[model samples]
Target: MLYFLKHKLVLLATPKTGSTALEQALAPLADMVLQGDPRIKHCTFQRYKWRMEKFIQIFEDEPPQTAALIRHPEDWLGSWFRFRHGSWLNGTTRSTRGLSFDQFVDGYLAEPQPAFAAVGQQARFLTHPKTGETVTHLYRYDAMSEFVAFLGQRLATTITLGRLNVSPEKELRLDPALRSRLEQRYAEDYALYDMALDKHPG
Candidate 1:
């Protein structure tokens, strides 16, 4: 799908939202891959902010069409917390062990940091960036199949739907108190995600 575009597709990956799946699926299609810091699977907010111009520069010659994959704030944050601090993977638990989700949310809210800020802040670049105009097409992690179809049409190529990063089958049961806290913690992100979801093609 990306190979057909050659230089026309720029995938600005957002972390922990099935970005790896998208990367694997589209790797064959991309002429150049812009993998971010190894510490972060995709671009951190700081990195994206600092290199927005360079990213824009990549599109100068042919003016590539851009796309990004995003996830719901609650789910994305949970995955990020688990991946960064929890025991999901072996030997990756040193930094984040024993940190409560509330504590993590509090720390994220208190600072202007990369990878820990609100998901809405991370997603703002999809619509508006400090350096340049925002890209038009975006894919919500929740609606992968529809996004794949949309991409297929735009790129005039076939895109196969693959395994999502988060499984819907095994639902995370959050206590009411915790759910409310999370909802409050990510209110802005919820609103932004709603707007993006509304804009998605039916």
Candidate 2:
């Protein structure tokens, strides 16, 4: 997560949603940056609202506006699977190396997910911890151009996002039946992506 005290904006670093590139790009301009570890980098929106807001209040009088990025549910899951399957995790419990995408989805839906399939629900990450409320300024990762444009306008600066993962994209052929449950689990993720542009109007 990144905080621009001058702009009064708090941008969440949603996992597997191209947050790294944007965070890196904007890091120098941010007044406060929370990153370099999973617990810090992927801090949930609710956690900040309830806990970290006081920390920022010392810097600025106004509560920062919350914003985040959401990738399509299927694509997000696929990225998670592929990310852990990298060579560095060859023999680790978190490795998806030998598993099919379908198998990964099955594991994700299991009651007690395995290390490899334990990625949390996207929508749950952005919801308010106590009230269950969600933010309106969410943007779609697929529509990055529009997102960058929105940010440029809001922050009053130019934003040029570069590709972070240039490796040839792998084919993600998740089973249709398993995909239904995947969608069900991340229903709000779909809703957010669908109406992202509306939430982040020009």
Candidate 3:
């Protein structure tokens, strides 16, 4: 996560959603940055509400405005599948090597997801557990230009981002039935992504 003390902006890092690029692009301008640890770097809005915001309120009347990016649910899971399918992890149980995209998603839908498909949901990461509140602003993962422009305007600096944490290329297709199941199981993520796209149609 990256926070700009002067701008009062907090950019929450949603996993696999260009967060690494944002961190690298904004770190030089940010007052504080949390990285290296998943729990810290990917801290959700709910955690920020009770912990970080509580502390920030000690010095300011209001907490910083929070923003995050959300990806299409299928694309998000595809990224995870290809990332773990890299040759370096071929022999590990965590690897998705040799597994079809459908199988990987099936693992995700399992009651107890296997290690390979245990990625957390974007909707869950962005929502407040108690109040059901999400971030103040949400950008679409596929719409990088809009997000970049917003950052430039808010931070008063031109921003550039390099691709980072890119997953391997793979054909990610699912049967119609499997996709229907995915949509049924992860409807909230789809809805949230649609909302973000509508908000920032870049």
State the C-alpha lDDT per candidate: 0.58, 0.83, 0.88
Off by over 4 Å in 2: 165-168, 198-200
Q: What's the alpha carbon RMSD for model 1? A: 4.9
lDDT of 2 by residue, 60-123 (tens): 7778888888888888888988888888889999999999999999999998999999999888
Candidate 3 residue lDDT tens string, 31-134: 87889989999998888888988877777787899988999899999999999999888888899988999899999999999998899999989998678899
Enumerate residue pairs that collide in model 3. none
lDDT value, residue 45 of candidate 2: 78
| Model 2 quality (TM-score) | 0.92
Q: What is the lDDT of residue 107 in candidate 1?
A: 54
| After superposition, candidate 3 runs with Cα above 4 Å error | 198-202
Write candidate 1's Cα lDDT for 1-202 as tens digits. 1223444555667666667677778777776665545434455444544564365556565455666666777677666666555335435423445556665555556556434433344455354445534544666777877777776776677877576554323224445666677678667566666755424465
RMSD of each: 4.9, 1.8, 1.6
Pick by TM-score: which candidate is best? 3
TM-score for every candidate vs. truth? 0.66, 0.92, 0.95
Ranking by TM-score: 3, 2, 1
